[model samples]
Target: MQKIGFSGTLDPITNGHMWVIGEARSIAEEVVVFLSENSTKAPKFSAEERKAIVLASCAERGWNNVAVQIVKSEYTARVAKRNGVGYLIRGIRSTADFDYENLIQQTNVEVIGGAKTLFVMPPRDLGSVSSSFVKALEGPVGWNWTMKKFVPAPAYKAWILAWLRKEWDSLWRERPHSAEWFERLTGEQAYGGAERHYHNLDHLVHGLAEIRAWAANTGAAPAHVALVKAAFWFHDAVYAHAAGEVSNEEASARLWLGSGLEPDAVRAEEVATLIRATDHFQGGAMLHPLKDTMLSVDLAILGQEAEVYQAYATGIRAEYAHVPEADYNSKRAQILAHLRGKAEAGTLFADPFFTDNYTAAAIANMSAELALIAGR
Candidate 1:
């Protein structure tokens, strides 16, 4: 099974690129789309954002064989060679595109031994549509229906949601207590905040999914489940970039309590206790059943498969990017050591669900992370 590579900035994936990816998928067993960064061009979107857009586009179009990756190197040839891609796929629109790509093809072949370049013309209707042209439509005038036609539907929806985030205040005023408002506020704090990397909306969503699964499995009461859901939303709402300096759980709890959204004092306290229980290192006395469940769900990431755990570690490091490597590693090791101690003592999770399913894997992940941090 030969892997074909397609490398592009993909700042905002266009319809043309989707068509080209579909064409490439037909020609190769696997199509790897390298979201390459270009030093010469100022990207409208970050590398991570572009990769996500491409991935979403692939998923939307049901391109099962296509995979999206963010290239560390700006050079496409280097990306192809690193990924063991034998052929580089390029989409050519016109004579000008052919001439430019022809030069690139020769250079790539020269730099990467045994690498071949394949050019495919996009559908005639979308041939001239490019990311640059699509970006031009996004100005003070804002995106219109015509602009939506040029880009993938998922990309356009993401763009519109991002645009809407800036106008959240107006939207909030119009629909207070609405799910959209709740999502917008949570999304802003989690995904749009500067410090968040791992404790983002995606993490919150994962927690919610786990909580729901556990609740259903255990036949938890509706009120108890609702409190758990609230705790999930506020657990990492106020993430602290610096380690051991401040308590994000406490801060997040306070934010939720003072938000004028809580039903009553008792319920607020329950949710607050649940959020604070996520402070795994503190090892405080548990007061509520939901606390045990929430804590288990929060630490579930530790029990994920190796690749998922690695990704979580990477995101945590990114969150603490401001800290020096040595300092970060030392702090991280201390945290992991505490978790390891709990796991060793058989007190990591009070909930049977987590004890039966996650305890062993969590301990294993902690041990691996501790060893890695020790070397650093």
Candidate 2:
């Protein structure tokens, strides 16, 4: 065929969608990605945004034969025919998907002078990879690594930024100065700074997930939940590129205090204190439950699966790229040794839940990392 059309809403465009596009490209000299609008449900990205993501992926793949266009009408046959598309390509992941798409295939083929339907299936491993499935991985720890496997190269970072925007918007939907506050936190000089490999907004997403998960289990009050969420959001808001110069926790706490949310004096001070608790070295004296929860969640990466912990350690190293390897490794080993001492003393995690679940894993992870650092 001279031309084939691949049509869908493609809210964020996953690898599964790309597989179908590849199939279309293989069968036709040219492929048109028809980004259609669905009025029944709102999409995460607009037509133009989705088109941009698709185009980026196409460019990344060096697909000169592919093009993207927004389609206004829901009817696929007339649109495909008008575009000179000889076939409309669709992806079938399972019998259920085939059942749904077969009806559309019949409709298109029945239309006078309309394009024929071409059904393609991705690899079995990608059968379950959908836009929604990829979207669900946005907040959990080590999500970036997992998401990278499913998203196209060009869309991975874009997806993270969009997810962060949504999360930041949701966090401050009812609050004042949201726009200004979010900009500062995500700007190049702050959490979104290029140096923030480990302490970036994605880290906040993981922390927020931990908070919500804790709340879900403990039935914590909404106020406490809100406080902790906000604290987590702004905890690393002002990470300086160099570690242990000025207190990043103190600066971030100040940023949170003056963030224009208009919290009363007590609330503001309490939040500042909560933010400061992230500075693990200055934190042993803290005995409050909320404080304990914040500290534990912030350190929870140490207890994540082995691969995730290794990634976290590598990111931390990347952030301190200015330092010489020997000095960096020496300082890192010192910090790990300090934390290991705390873990051995049975005071590494304060929250009883984390103390029981994460303390041992955290110790093991840190010790392993420490050994690696020493060997180097």
Candidate 3:
């Protein structure tokens, strides 16, 4: 009853492909290898030939519960579910592949309710070996490229090409300013979520807007403004289905690098580092360049007048509504704890506007909110 499925086309499976299958087989009671067709990519063999080769390969290795079959449909999840398979396996070789594959896994869940995708990282020795590289050299270089020795007989080169092509298409097509792109890239929308989930595009934009206003009021340095604004947009770039604490920082760097911002690499790196520093809410002790940036971002929420604070705060609550109640509560507590801890340590607000008039205002605003939960 332990059925596992692998969907690919074996034009010439590589050693990396075979390694993943070997590892998958050890963990599954039965392995169903599905040779996918209807691919718009290079194919060196017919689907029937590839299926037979896969069967022979599994048999040669004496692997039980290994069956090779063809799936004509494009839906890998539907095929797996029909076969009573519970696991969808993918092979990851690099960070780029991981990012691309992670998106697919998230989409699969949406496409097929309860379907899961598990990625197995290829061993370091085989990390750089891919079918594409081999195929590109096979014809002109006159090199033998039969993947039977390295890949399972059922491995489909066409399927991998299609997967890569699809990923590339999506990546190239993504619009930086499109709400549709935002939904496709991340499960969350720019606005309207739970209180604990308030950090989104709108929140980031709001934070930057406030940063600009605070800068204008205080005559802040231009470099500080640019760094802060870049961090605001890039901070959430690496968000995935199961993002963790450092997701913001990681994504920031990825976005900066992908955007070919290398000439400003130092500043971009500093921006990423500053965003990470914001996670710690100690008032003034934050790292040099970004400590002020963090205060600006934080104060942007609580330093406003009562009317402005209430209006922004309402939107903040809605942005986080999708977050589970428990998670929402925990994050809210963390933010509050950070604020309290920062104030106690004398690091909460260091900028001129905050140092002069907004410091007490920010504290008073959060104090009221904290008191609401403190008594509960």
Q: Using lDDT, give the best candidate's number.
A: 2
| Model 3 lDDT, residue 61, Cα | 73
Candidate 2: pairs in clash: none
Report the C-alpha lDDT of model 2 over 22-105, residue by residue, as the tens digit: 888888899998888777768877788888889999988898898988888557667888878878888889999999888777
TM for every model, in the order presented, reads: 0.55, 0.86, 0.41
Deviation of model 2 at 245, angstroms: 7.7
- Candidate 1 structure quality by residue, lDDT tens digits, 246-313: 57777777777876566578888888888878765553765776677888888877877676677789
Best by TM-score: 2
- Give lDDT per model, in order: 0.75, 0.81, 0.60
Candidate 3: stretches off by over 4 Å: 1-197, 237-246, 280-290, 311-334
Candidate 3 Cα deviation (angstroms), residue 161: 37
Ten-residue segment with the worst summed lDDT in candidate 1?
167-176
The TM-score obtained by model 2 is 0.86
Better of 1 and 3 by TM-score: 1
